[model samples]
Target: MVYRQEIMLTGAGGQGLILASIILADAAVQDDKNVVQTQSYGPEARGGESMAGVILDIDPIYYPRITSPTVLLSMNQQSFNKYIKRAGENCLVIVDSTFVEDVGNQPAYSYPITARTRLELEKEIVANIVALSIVNTMADLVSRQALQESVLKYTPEGSSDLNLQALELGRQLTHSYD
Candidate 1:
């Protein structure tokens, strides 16, 4: 079967979902897949709503927008409530349990992403990297090497070790969920 994925990552503006989307798109490209990414955030910037869309396919992509996401990552309750309506029936729904209190019957995989990042990693900013790794691992979207390379390439210097640890933690968290 032809491989295709429409992924949407949503959260508050400062949560880094846009960066995650970019990293995912970059990883897809590294794996030789055709990919497109787009993002939008509310006026408040840091606290406002934010969403990023990424589409990956083995064949050429005709549309850049995501109408029905095959995978949805919601970092907060507001984004979860707003974007869950657009997910495909079989979409993989993953939510950050730290900020999202409810899933409302949508079979979602929940993780304490922010809590883990803050408590375990001692840095909450890397929560986006955690979330990205979780989504990538759960969805089996790209090779681990490709994803790791993309994460390293996008993350700032001196932060590679923490980001890699965050990625591994995410993978561990996903396994624990199952």
Candidate 2:
């Protein structure tokens, strides 16, 4: 049997959603799964909205876009509002609680990811890494080892440790939600 899953990572520009999507797709490749990754960002580049989509399957994928996601990681209210309604009932919606206030009645795992990245890690730039960790842990979309390797691969040479720490923080955050 063939299985397919779509994942969407959304936030403002400069949040590293595109890099995270690429890393995820690379991990899928390492795991011998077929994956297609795509991204879009607003013109403003910094505060504007950003979205990354990944479609994974055990077989060849005919379509490259994700109309609805099996999982969603929303980092800001705008991205959350834009994509959350399109999510199916079974979607695993993970939101950055600090920036996204209204999650409505939808079953979601909310975490203070940005706050933790800033306060705990003292590196606000690693928030996206934290989100990736949470998504990887909760969705089990790829092997932890593979995801870790991919993280190290995509992260800047001197900053892997911080990103790795953020990843661990993200994993730990999932325990509270579970």
Candidate 3:
């Protein structure tokens, strides 16, 4: 089977979701997959809406835009409300339960992403990495080693251990859901 995915990651601008998308795209490339990534954010740059879209396929991807995402990850309530409507009916929805209280009857995998990052990893900034790890584990999107390499490559110096712990915590959280 040809591997293909249209992934949308949404949240506020300061949430680091764009970086997460880049990491995911790089991991896909590391796995020898063709991938394209794009992003947009509001003027406020921090609290304003932000979204990143990534398309991955074994075959060539002619278009980079995501009209109907196969996977949707929303980090906040506003993003969840805005982008969830654009998702396909069969889209796999993942929400950060710490920020999104209402999933509106959608079959969403709710995780305490920011809360876990703060409580477990002691740094909420790595919540994006945790969320990426959760999405990767749940979707089986890429090799764990590739993802780890990408994470280490993209993250800042001296924070590798925390990010790695965040990744493991995310995987453990997904398993706990099952």
Candidate 4:
């Protein structure tokens, strides 16, 4: 099991990468782990590049930024191109199959995250939560219950069920990664 792990989530500004990172960090914190989260975005709000980094450790965190991530979640082609090359050798590179088509020959997990949300749940905004569920399941970054609780805590009111459904669908999608 990994004691210290670095995770990076990248997408367009409106894709909710920041929220996903927060949820992941919150779950880690709930588990009594030390987690540090940092985010960056381009000048534009919606269409610009967005990135969030989280470092998790059992001991006190000395640094919050991630130079090389062990897990990279790329929600678009641009993010995939920007972060994949810098990922660690065994990095679990996850890409949104619906939006990222240029993953090259990398051994990565590809899923139609937003497509599943739109087609199944009828809402694409919860794609981040879905992606988070996938990450939590595949990487064992956090417990399912903790991740679910963090999702419900961070999710806006009146949409808990929708996000929960998305999270469940994402968990179901984890089989595809194997």
What is the per-residue lDDT of model 1 for residues 16-134, given as tens digits with 9 covering 90 to 100? 88999999999999999999999988788689999999999988989789978999999999999999989878999999999999898889999999999899999999999999999
Instruction: List TM-score per model, in order.
Output: 0.97, 0.96, 0.97, 0.96
Backbone clash count, each prediction separately: 0, 0, 0, 0
Candidate 3, position 19, lDDT = 99
Cα lDDT of model 4 by residue, 84-154, tens digit: 88987889889999999988989989999989889999889899999999988888988888988999999
Q: List the candidate 4 regions with Cα displacement exceeding 4 Å.
A: none
RMSD of each: 1.0, 1.0, 1.0, 1.3
Q: CA lDDT of each candidate?
A: 0.93, 0.92, 0.94, 0.91
For candidate 4, give the lDDT: 0.91
Ranking by lDDT: 3, 1, 2, 4
Candidate 2 structure quality by residue, lDDT tens digits, 58-95: 98988898987999999999999999988998899999
131-174: candidate 3 lDDT, tens digit per residue: 99999999988999999999999999999999999999999999
Write out the backbone clash pairs for model 4.
Answer: none
